[model samples]
Target: MSEAATRTVTTPPGLLASLDPLLREWLPRQRWFAGKGRPVTGFSLVAATELLPSTATLGLYHLLVRAHQPLLPGHVGAEQPGDCYQLLIGVREALPPRLAPALIGHVTQGPLAGRTVYEALHDTRPAELLLEALRTQARIGGLRFERDPNREIRSGLVPRLVTAEQSNSSIVYGDTFILKLLRRVVPGINPDLELPLALARAGCPRVPPPTAWLVADPEVPAGAPQPVEPYVLGVLQPFVQGATDGWELALRELAKGEDFVAEARDLGRATAEVHTVLARALPTVTLGHSQLRLMVDGMTERLEAAVHAVPALRPHASGLRSAFTALDDLAAEGHTWTAQRVHGDLHLGQCLRSPAGEWSLIDFEGEPARPLAERRMPQPAVRDVAGMLRSFDYAARSADPPQPEWAERCRAAYCSGYAEAAGRDPRTDPVLLRAYETDKAVYEVLYEARHRPEWLSVPLTAVRRLAASGLT
Candidate 1:
């Protein structure tokens, strides 16, 4: 880390006067910190709302912090500062020995300099306050807790922080309700909340609807040109009883050398059911010549970017580009595509198989790295199918010696089931499906190259196969 790693905060210094130094060291250690490997240039206090009055035995605070990172080379606009994050802070007179791990270091400066501070979500007492606030639909300072009127959150449910989570902090209340607190708070409507509500309204049973949600709607500065985007603080949903995520289920089956085609078929059907409901509930669009051109252009652009990011992709760039070009050819020949709201980022890990042998989808938040607006935009349902296919490929490759045949069998079965439920065969549109699959593989190539170099072969194989010929 360079000395330039210091955050050059944009907001007034007073807001974080006490916790600045502590957070500088603390934020980077968090998994949800988006600017990892980059120097935190500074911070701006977007909003700091006290959930409880200072006189309380345990003072709770909700803070919206913007962290700025130094620009990266050849990355346009990366130099711009401020990626917003949400934090729950619990202040106390003394830190308990058992809660030492949750400490954010002692606050040595600020109006409350002598107080001890830690992550509130880690402490059960403070964690329950969040639920209480939601149950009562309370507003403390700038924070607002809203609930679905038709739903009820039972009382006396013990709160436990889910430690294995990435990107956000989740608290499960006695295995009844799960609250996912958004760590990197983005300004706009979050798909995690929006999609589930729509699905629930459409009576889509494959997903559990949001029971309640929390948001921060701060007053914008006078004369600001744009409306202040409401920050999505957190969302509460019913906890799936005795559920195993699809990824785990697939892995277990792989280890057992058992056929997963049946389960895969069921998952595919559930996916199609959700898509059908989404298409009917939300706005749908038809991609004409111009729209298809834009879609192809975006895919090509991503391929070019991935090639540069991961040198291993350079060799297959031309072959991959052909897939995108084929989409244009289809449009030129009078073929049109339908676009609808989809699970923008779908994978086995994002689904759960219940004890009743039912498949339910979770996490409608799409790709977290992409802008919220893009995640919400209607796109071809095949994009989601492509994602699931890639996930199957990953599962097979991760197995001992790899099981290409098993993956192929499951893939075919899944698609067959999807066609049965969707009333349209995805294989019939090989050109569109292949393009999306190639794009997904390209994304995996870049991701695996950066995070798991050894795992590069998984997606690299798909890239070569997709670029060279048809899905085997």
Candidate 2:
């Protein structure tokens, strides 16, 4: 490696002092920490801010942070850990004078950080930020906090963070809010933070608001947020529960031989609503056909590469090109469509089926690898719609552990719901819709090959259907 490429990392001063050698070692070992493995010995805080205090009694400080910490080669795919931050939102009755021993040392911190001795047992301080987050979700859902999650979290409503393998941590509360925890911590507003906020404000249904995010205060000292650093560690919002994940649900329906045309329609309508909302919500930007063309061209190349690597996906390779060409044609028509925000990673798994047979979306935080700005930009909401419509097809076939008929019925129901809502007759734009589904399948083919090969057929079958229909 070059001199500059030795690959070790350092942190800002004044953070993680009390932990000593062990503390430093412990942080990197954490499942959530991206700077794991390579031994991030030093660090600094980019910013820090105190989150809103809890609404429920006994909830205390809620702080968000941004930090500049070391990068182990294994943690980041990029050259180095891009702008990232750490977040500590625990409550402390009285902050230790020395600030030693740390909060996460034990799970006890969130349960009883800063209240009277007994209150600590029933404490809501540490996770208080989450309590307030749940309140926001409840406000949106129009429900009251009938029971405390600390005690009755099971039935009523609870906002507790659930750890996921992604770069950050997640807090799923009331089975309604899903918070994505960003590990390598970055500063500035996150795309997920910005887009959802805009979506909620724009009156888009189905998608949740960004609500509150924990960013480090810019002026905080270096090395960790110090309970006061710079950078945002997590974004909190409403969670969607009891809803069948679109991917699994679709596959199940498909395995049972059910048509998901209706499900496709509902997804279409929701996507249209999102696009329509985006068109109005965002400042419109005019772009020539060049950008769209470039993107399509790139996607085509990616598809081909993926098919070559995985023979099963090879069959969809041509369909992918055809679909891209069709979308490209739409862009080239010179209608001058407006640019608005998009659910960058919009797809089947991103949505859910509520108990009411309704749908809700999760994961507004764009693709983790993309630049924050690009991911936040508003584009045709049609893109998201396209993503879902294609998903319906995936349902018709990809459902594993298999029920083909059930998948078909699900497809039909979903389509019915979406069409009734979007009002854009699928019949009117049959070609367009087919192209969208094919495109989506192509995307899936490539996506699964790279991330989860076992699921490759999910998209492959959809392409086969679209191609067999001679639609694209």
On TM-score, the leading prediction is 1
Give lDDT tens digits, candidate 1, residues 435-460: 99999999898888877899999999
* lDDT string, candidate 2, 1-472, tens digits: 1232122222223323422333354555655554433555444434322233333443332222222355543465434543343544333444353333334442223333233211111223445544554333231111112212322223334545453355556656666555565665455566666666678777676776665554434444457545432344456565655668777766665556666565655665665566566667677776557867766676677667667767876665565567677767877886344456677777788777776766666677666655665666765555565565555555544445555555455455555655576665444455445655665666677667766888776766666777667542
Decoy 1 TM-score against native: 0.94
In model 2, what is the error at residue 72, expressed in angstroms?
A: 13
Off by over 4 Å in 2: 1-78, 81-125, 129-159, 163-168, 172-185, 202-205, 208-211, 219-268, 285-288, 304-319, 326-339, 396-417, 426-443, 463-472
lDDT score, residue 365, model 2?
Answer: 67
Model 1, residue 459: displacement in angstroms? 0.7
Scored by CA lDDT, what does every candidate get? 0.87, 0.53
Work out the TM-score per prediction: 0.94, 0.61
